[model samples]
Target: MKIKDFPHAGETPPFGAGGSGVGLYIHIPFCKQACHYCDFHFSTSLKKKNELVDALCQEMILRKDEIPGPLQTIYFGGGTPSLLEAEELAQIFKTIDSHFEVNPDAEITLEANPDDLTEAKLKMLAASRINRLSIGVQSFFEEDLKLMNRAHNAIEAVTCLELAKNYFDNISIDLIYGMPDMSDARWQENLDKTLALDIPHISSYALTVEPNTALQKFIEKGVVKPVDDAVAQGHFEILIERMQQAGFENYEFSNFGKPGYYSQNNTAYWTGKSYLGIGPSAHSYDGETRSWNVNSNPKYIKAIQSGELPIERETLSVTDKYNEYVMTGLRTIWGISLIKIEESFGLKFKEYALQQAQKHIEEHLLFLDQDRIVVTQKGKFLSDGLASDLFLINLS
Candidate 1:
């Protein structure tokens, strides 16, 4: 079962023939402590970390025939990949290298927590194949950190970046805005501090209360103030203005990067490229089909041990694919190509898109930038909502 021998090898037309490349997303779902706002699938215990890692590697071997070509990017996300020991990483890499053809200069990324990235750990990562770091440095203030229940302190946040920059040239930090009671001055300080470190990329998001999370519970109990939408929009505006001023390109909504520093892994996902996601609760896409593993660690491990995949699959309809294209394309600078939409989804779908987008264009929320439909600055903050408005609700 050769990967290249598979028909429709990769998702996009250009993928197998030097177009959009394949990616691997490895979810490590163990965290030292859960953040208040996080609702991602994870556990606070490391009891199954070793077993889970083994299952992940096994799943890769079992699904070796799925991907099309050599991987251009490999992302180690969730449960703090930095928590894994160097030996564990080596074993995982050995399995991957033996099974797949990884590009020599592939963009291998590992999501790290500031507290976990000690000097020793950084040195190990520097020597390893992981070439990029996405550090979780939500805030540089004690009050903000305490509110979010983040494990790393403000000092560790600053120190980690200082040390990380010395080891890795490509570094991205996560920053949260719109926290309860966060002020403009405080938000400015966070940006100022981040800029001071000269980080190459930034992924910023507004703090939102997710159902069943500690933050949601606190908000429900009035223990924490609710997130204000207007305040969040204001913060986002400030972020865009500042980041653009700093010469960073807002390549995608919530993501800003310097030229040549955009995240290859996420970019592939946005551009409809195929990726294989390993581990519990992770998702994989092979163009037409979307599959996800069970979210429970025990179940995921048991199924793999029993030689079962433990994954549920869904084959997307034509309408579903078109909606996804609109949603992702509108949020990106590349925008949606009208000709591609017409050719791929048929002339009627393209006409419907143009008709639905006409109102927003009149409202100054969207406009035709040559052959592509793009969000104007006035519509940037509300791009998701605007994109949704243009979706094909009834494709029958």
Candidate 2:
């Protein structure tokens, strides 16, 4: 079949035609060690790295027909995509180039760790097609680094950013806030250091202890103090104020970016654009259905090598789509469109949404802007809960 003649042709508007375009997410499931708060799919052992890389390339070939046209964004996310050798990245990129037509201005990003980004490595990446870098510099303090067990030290975080700035222009760094012992002053210092570095984009989040993770176990055993939501909320408020003062847009709940520096890959996802995800535990969506590959590395490699895809699929219900739209839209700067809800899902759903949102609006947590419902600055942190209250449980 011709690449442009895919099954869902014309189902959605093409990005080049002024709408959001398709994206590709390649998951690399290898890390030197696991972080205490992380629950994402990954393994510490690099024994199967070669086999996994081969599987990733093969999976791309198998799913190349799934994309409608040229890719607008390509993201290498994971346990540490920076761990891949230059040659490995080349081989993968060669396969992508051969099978797909990438846009000349495509936003190709690679998620890296601070320790892996040496001067040599930065130079190597600058020479490649990766135009953006998302470095995992979770914290800038030595105690926080030790508590989280991050591979890089505080100095490495600063040094890598200094070196990386000389090579790449579009750079983003991750920061975590609201740890047990984190004071308001400490959080402010973190923001201060980020601004001093002149980073273009920042993705920060409150530290949450996930079930079965080391953090959870520690909290349970009293070895580590339990996380306090009040502290997290305070940190979040500080973050918003600081970033605003620094001329950064709180584009999404957890992301802040300078003008023209927003993450295209992430924006597409929040706006409900389709994307093709490759590699083990990666997810793929094509407007209607959502599918994910097997999370087990050995199983994934074996399946791909045998010319089979180890995936599971689910077709979203109308209510499911509406709920998702409300959830994502509320968290973003682009407010939920009452017109879109009614036009796409029917007048009943739109009316239901407004009726549900009325209470919050009266409380000064929400407001109507012409034909859309937007969260107030006071409501931004509670977007998820507010969105849930507007969900239609019986519409499906």
Candidate 3:
């Protein structure tokens, strides 16, 4: 059955209107092959696909009471959400419809790889309730794809976008920069191609070698060159320049979008809205507490089948909340609100935040716009570090 047959399928809700509505994140932790630099929890084998899907649905039903409000956004993130068959997707959608109050114009998104977006699959997805597609293109060059061991080749990358654009209007593609031997010129060409395709939203990130990953071993063995922070910084500058000229706002550190195409699901997260995360290795956040399910497929399935939740929870302290706000706020175009710090936190917290920000302001890496502490263009690349400097280690 198609998702349009469901009651909540209709025109999209007004952009930025559902800031208070809840979000749902369904994690499909299965992949055909593992990327070299990846560290997310997932299995290369689909031996438990059917069981996992059932467990996902069960988890939704088990935790339905956690979310009392209508869902404004539902995201299918993964190891590869596109790997699910049409029937499997339909089953999950049916469960969501039965248990949750989904807004008629909810922003439903599914993340897909370029190779998975064959014409038939695109047609199937377009007919479903998924109104947005986040394609994992990574790069438009063969060498880069091979280095990262992405499932799709450069040809499939471009071809999928060509076909997907026909069926999906709200599309976002991922692009990686700062790889070894990725020259500034080559990075520019990648951006040029993305703009040429007229994709609405783009999420780009620098390549980092995570500990215990294949990338780290490769670098240790000298099979791959180490990642250079200076090189990454230069490429980021180029990215900021190119996307701005294309009229795409760098709304968040790694995300860029046109006027009306920002990701509502992610925006909700940055603004501290609560979301329910389902499936193995998924995390859920309420306004004050954070929780995550067990990160093992077999274990997660076993627990759910037994009517138990294999989960862990943590409650945020006032210091924890203030620190999180500073971290997420600085990474976005919204910056940190001094008034929010005082109101949500306390007067002491606001005084400490301003005190910490003075150094960045004097160095011209940050500035005060009215009452907001905003990062300057020169400071954008170092936003994370800047935010850390502003973090309160102990508020006792």
Candidate 4:
């Protein structure tokens, strides 16, 4: 059936005819090795890598104009996209530029492992149009790296940042807090090292053990201790305070950045900008509809080769739209804009949200800016629960 026959969700105003623009996410599902805690789609075998890259290019060409807005941002996220040689990555970007009307100033970000980056590699990336690099520097401690089974050691993680600064001004690094063994002093050391770097963006994630990962299995077998809530909470406090002291803004729950160094593509996604996703396990949204490619390498390749897109989509319901806005909005530093919230969900929602805010405000977990309802530091931990309380439950 045509998208118009789906529902009246996007038919409402502020959400546009189908809503705000789109962003393209390309997943390069190849990795030299897997981290014990990761559950993302990736394989360690290099046998099919060359073919996979070709398939990815073909996938991009196959859905060149699938979404709208000409494509403002293109993100190369992955198991470790930096594992590929610069020429290979360039070939894929070339395909995108040829087919998608990518803006001249579009943010082209590549996710890389610290081990994969070097001065030579950085120079090659700089020569290409790739403007940003999001490095996987999970921890700056050797013991933590060992526990996480990360590919790079503590020394390599630090060195990569030094090398990366020579090539890219817009750089983002991922740091994982809340490890069972990561002490406050150790955590402080990691934060100090990260702040010393000249990079702009930082994505500090709380470690979560998802189902079926090796970490979970190890804990199940009693080979490792599970995460400690008290320890995690302590480290979280350290992260917030330390980053704030370093002059970084907590732009999102897991993201912090120096002034103007925010990830344009990711910010667009959170603020409801649209983008196409290509390759295996990639997700795409055209504002009204949400779609994602198949997670299997062979299956994704086969579908693209056979002139079919390996994807499934869902038309957004009014309820889905409201819940989505609530989910994404409440996690940012900007918080929920009461004015926009009213315009988008209606006066009833704004009232209920304010009512919910009152309880948090009394606890000092929330506050009101001139026009926005911003969550305080204490509220960030229970953000999901708080957001759920404000959700438009009966907005069918």
Give the candidate number with the greatest lDDT: 3
| Candidate 4 C-alpha lDDT tens digits along 202-296 | 88888889899999998899887888877877888888888878878776778887877777776776667777888898988766888888999
Show pairs that collide, candidate 1. 14-19
Cα lDDT, all candidates: 0.88, 0.89, 0.90, 0.79
What TM-scores do the predictions have?
A: 0.95, 0.95, 0.95, 0.91
Which segments of candidate 1 are over 4 A away from where they belong? 1-20
lDDT (Cα, tens digit) per residue for candidate 3, span 312-378: 9999999999999999878777777888889999999999999999999899887776667777778
Clashes of each: 1, 0, 0, 6
List per-candidate RMSD values in Å.
6.5, 6.7, 7.0, 7.1
For model 4, what is the error of residue 48's alpha carbon versus the real structure, in angstroms, after optimal superposition?
Answer: 1.7
When summed lDDT is taken over every stretch of 10 residues in candidate 4, the lowest stretch is 8-17
Which pairs clash (backbone N, Cα, C closer than 3 Å) in model 4? Answer: 21-274, 22-274, 22-275, 23-274, 23-275, 23-276
Report the C-alpha lDDT of model 1 over 1-396, residue by residue, as the tens digit. 232222222223232113346999999999999999999999999998899989999999999889898899899999789999988999899999989989876889999999999899999999999999999999999999999999999999999999998899999999999988999989999999999999999999999888899999999999998899999999999999899899887867888988778888768877788899999999999989999999999999999999999999999998998999999888876678788888888888888899999999888787675567777767889999998988986675
Model 2 ranges off by over 4 Å? 1-20
Which candidate model has the greater lDDT, 1 or 3?
3
Using lDDT as the yardstick, the better of models 1 and 2 is: 2
